[model samples]
Target: MKGFKEFLLRGNVVELAVAVVIGAAFTNLVNTFVKGVINPIVGAFGTKDLASYTSCLKGPCETGPAGEVTSGVLILWGSVLSAALQFLITALVVYFVLIVPMNRMAARRKSLAEEAVEAEAKEVKLLTEIRDALVAPLR
Candidate 1:
């Protein structure tokens, strides 16, 4: 029980959980953009929704009253293409918006830490030399 609690509370685990939740939410935004904006432009070229684009493989494809597929062996390549575009957009946004900025911030932090350590070392060396000089005449 204690181990499980610790695991759940661990920083990496918590960060991962948050990331997953955020990613899921971000996916909805991406989907909305693609469906609302990109899809229409793409539709102007062909169908209104890329998901609606399909090719029959085995027999005549059948659609219900609402235009939903009832029976068919479809290639459904357009749906795949749409999904691939969504993935690409998500990747690009995450890379440019999150990853790139985070990396730059981390690098800045690392450089500052290194400078602090160096400053502390120099101060310590100076203090040690002062102590040596003060004690030299007495020795």
Candidate 2:
């Protein structure tokens, strides 16, 4: 129970939970944008949804009264295209808006930390030399 509590309170765990929530919210916004804006543009071309575009490979495709597929092998390339476009947009936004900036920030911090370590090492070396000089004179 104690270990579980500590794990839950860990920085990474907390940050991950926050990130999941934010990501879900962002995805919803993007989906809305695609549906409201992109879908309409696609509709102007032919169909309202990219999923409606399909090709039958086998027997004649039949649809029920409600437009549900009754029988046939349908290659729904339109839905695939729409999904691919959405994924591409999401990846580009994540890379440019979040991942790239975060990576750059991390690199900057690491460089500063390395410089500080080097400075500390030089100070330690100087102190050791001073101590050796004083002890040698006494000897």
Q: Pick the candidate with the highest TM-score.
A: 2
TM-scores for all candidates: the values are: 0.74, 0.75
Task: Give the CA lDDT, 0 to 100, for residue 76 in model 2.
Answer: 90
Q: Clashing residue pairs, candidate 2?
A: none
Report the C-alpha lDDT of model 1 over 1-139, residue by residue, as the tens digit. 9999999999999999999999889999999999999899998999979987778977888888997778877688889999999999999999999999999999999999999999999999999999999999999
Q: For candidate 2, lDDT tens digit of each residue in 40-86?
A: 89999898888888999789999899988899977899988888878
TM-score of 2: 0.75
Give per-residue lDDT, candidate 1, residue 44. 93
Poorest stretch of ten by lDDT in candidate 2: 29-38
Q: Rate the local accuracy (lDDT) of all candidates.
A: 0.93, 0.91
Question: What shift in Å separates residue 30 of candidate 2 from its native position after superposition?
Answer: 1.6
The candidate scoring highest on lDDT is: 1
- The alpha-carbon deviation from the true structure for residue 113 of candidate 1, after best TM-score superposition, in angstroms, is 1.3
